[model samples]
Target: MAAYAVSIAKEDNMSTSDITKMLEAHADRLPTESGTTSFTLTDLGDNRYRITGSRATSKHFSRILGMNSPTLSSSAEIAKGGTPAPCVLATNTSPSNGRGIEMNNNARMTISGCSVQSNATGSSSVHLTQAFITVTDGSGPGKLCHGGGVYQANGNAVSATKELCATVTDPLAASLPTPTPTGTTYGNPGTDYSWYGSKTFQPGIYSSGFVANNGRTHYLEAGTYYITGGNFEAQSGAKIIANGPITIIVMNGGTIRITDYSASANSFQAPQTGPYAGILMWRVNNGSCPNPITFAGGAGFTYDGVLYFPGCLLDVSNNAHISTRSEFTYVLADRIMMVGGSRMTIDVDNPYGLAANLGGGGSGGSFALVK
Candidate 1:
């Protein structure tokens, strides 16, 4: 009957033909059990649930479904150049729960260093609060994910040995790319207006929001810089240059920080290919964090790409070292502050996989488990 009822919510880049078009749009307001295609449950929230189907005339899509596969989400074994490409995320919507990768500068929250390259694990990516989150600093390299939870404080431990994953699939927040772009809308360069003697900027849609007046030397002529009311800031400077596929989209408000603490001669670079190739800076999540965005990268900084900007509260301070040398970097925010000695590296292979295939974390259809 209409694929055994409908109402398959749980969105966020949903796929599988959008659940067979929502079970062809309801089976008499039924709502449970789907057989024509064999049961297909999906919730994946704290309680968790995601039972795909294949061979069966009907065993259960209702009755609370099922979760017998040695415990649905089981993962452990990834640390040597294998599954480590959500880039660098801390997408915790901020109710404050260990702060994902938030460090107070005691040092040791290196999710991938700038130089001493060796440890590059962090498979599930790293999220916190609800579940599946961690940070380590005992031996580095995520300590090969001991998965027992031990985020030592007092010394600011990120990994005395951390790793408790079962599915944090946020493969780039639904294939990202929506900074609101229509046509031409730029304004508000007030306050004695002076972008450091105009270096060169020709993008679009500013809408009463365009103020970058720090020790400047700007040059962004690539495309897309849709900044809303919140006057963008790249202060703490002596330089803030952009010479590539550029993109900087902030939303409703003001004083939204992007990069500062003087990355020295900041040299931004994204769009290595097209369609905003990894991404350069996107802070448009109007859920909260009124205006908390202070991202700094030091030592003559050279931004490579991808700084997603989830909900709010993203401040990676001081000697912030992001994207190190870029092999295609990424950084999701919504509560990420590895204060002072912040070292958030990038380069686990993104040759533009861009979420592998897409449908929420790419690689199409993905989930498979059979014995």
Candidate 2:
């Protein structure tokens, strides 16, 4: 009897479709017996379900069940079910070339179950510098086979052997302009200003810490915001909407933290040009311990600016979507980490182009390495 049951189970495993049909037919009457094996199916609600049974039956359950739609194939393909990643990670093909993600210095990137799609059609997905890249748990270039792979400056961009790898030069080496702090002392050092709650402000030097929280929306006019001391935070559904050009300068041990994972997460965007051209969040070297600058927002969050903080750690994640809806985005930080389903875009066909103000164009500074 035992031999007979094992034989029957092996035969049943050969055809997943048949097993699925049997399961669906008996959906209302789960925990049914199938050839001496009892299986239990529980509806998890919201079109999702969970099934448990003998090892042989549950093996390859998801693959055997199969998805109605295609999954993430490469970093260059748009996400089929979830939010599309902003960077391009596809390989290069004919006529149309694919853009790639670029990371620099000792920075690291890790991606899992995410699709890094190209900004445009027929472009590569990733362009990485001398950084470590890691991909695991079903992460890769999406859809298109060509122009959806890893292009590294030193060697193969991807850490996984199964990834499509190629050789490419670091395009961002020249574009990131080093900020030369120039100005007579504008504000006294060690001053603290806490601009909290909901309100609007004109552009000028903010001589202290700036905090916006409690579902507040702070509006800033076209100008520069100089944060002299302490940290800058926008949390708890807080938002900073820019009506015109704006720049945020974090100095004297000051940092920037944008948090709260909700759709109304703390969010803001800077301009694309002017005296602060190609620069948005600037943190000067104040001889203090480096702090992490966190950016968290919803899918509508689109930031166009250069985040220049050579003395700080950059944390960009949390279902945030920094679309390339504007001109471009450039950053120069001590270290960087991008994960948590965040999509930071670098549009390929934009009129302003990548780091245009800093004299960047055509594949330079266009890649980020995922470690």
Candidate 3:
């Protein structure tokens, strides 16, 4: 029988239907099972092939081709001119061993639009070493996995242009979580400078000095503190330690002058706090206090913490000189509105090379400057 034929139609172009008919005819020429008809269509051209009906089993197809019976060389492969169209093997019934598809060492394969669900023990999906695999949307809804979605290892690198979505069945089981924003704030200056603690004033004109006696700590809190009219000198051994947290909120349009009075070693400590520690002036928070705060004077000031202000407006016409004794220095605020004609300088230096967490955590946060 001329099982395979090449016929020329009116049009010179050869159609795929013609090639399929030729291959089917060739397959039918082979011997059949005793009483069974000796007609079948198995191989497609271009190094690709297919199996259908009851003869689709590994044994039946392997015996006809004279090759080893494969556990799963299952799908149909279409011929595409030069190379073989990638094979797609699928199964209706679950495999006892949970093995889905296995490709030859040199087989270049790609799987798309499939799903693996309710599998036990073995991985839901597997890609071997040196295998290039890509998952893409097909005619259907796309791929899904229940047990272990897709497992690609053995030094394999996977990449996707789109986002990967997954749902976890259990909450306690190790899984990724959505992130939240928790910002840091300066301490309250009123409480920090009370008789309980010590407040360090920069080189500036203060009417009164910060009096500390008998190991007592006196510092200011976030609220306003009264000071007489005089040059509040930061003497040779003047240091400010915030007993709790301190935020210098200038209220009633009061002016505080911070100058660098140290002839040699002048240092200020600005420690990190939670949600409210820093410099705030000309700002009103009706929720807490409705008084407007104001800040003035720009002398050389050094703080070993973060400088932040959101609600208050600043006048930097007198550019303040700021420096840090330690290498770790971070300047962060809710909103920094630098007025025209003001100069501000910041210096961060730590001799031991220690980096402090300016935003509480070393990394992973947001910083914004609103007019």
lDDT of 2 by residue, 1-371 (tens): 11111101210001123233444454333332222333443433321223343312222454577833222111111111222222223212221234333344444444332223222122334445565555332222322112345456754355443333232212233444443344323342212234445456665555656666666667766767777766767676656677776778777888888776343433345655565665667777565535777775553355566556654556666655554423334444444445555545443224233324342312222111111
Candidate 1 wrong stretches, greater than 4 Å: 1-84, 89-154, 159-223, 226-232, 235-246, 249-274, 277-305, 308-315, 318-329, 332-337, 340-366
Against the reference, the lDDT scores of all candidates come to 0.47, 0.44, 0.30
Mind giving the per-residue lDDT tens digits that candidate 1 earns over 289-340?
Answer: 6767776655336566666777666666666565434545556565455555
Total backbone collisions for each predicted model: 13, 48, 53
Cα lDDT tens digits for candidate 3, 157-203: 33322122232121111221211212233333332444443444332
Ranking by lDDT: 1, 2, 3
Candidate topping lDDT: 1
- Give the lDDT of residue 366 in candidate 3: 20
Number of backbone clashes in candidate 1: 13
Models, CA RMSD each: 15.7, 18.7, 29.0
Highest TM-score scorer: 2
lDDT of 1 at 301: 61
Q: Give candidate 2 regions above 4 Å deviation.
A: 1-197, 261-273, 287-289, 297-300, 326-328, 351-356, 360-371
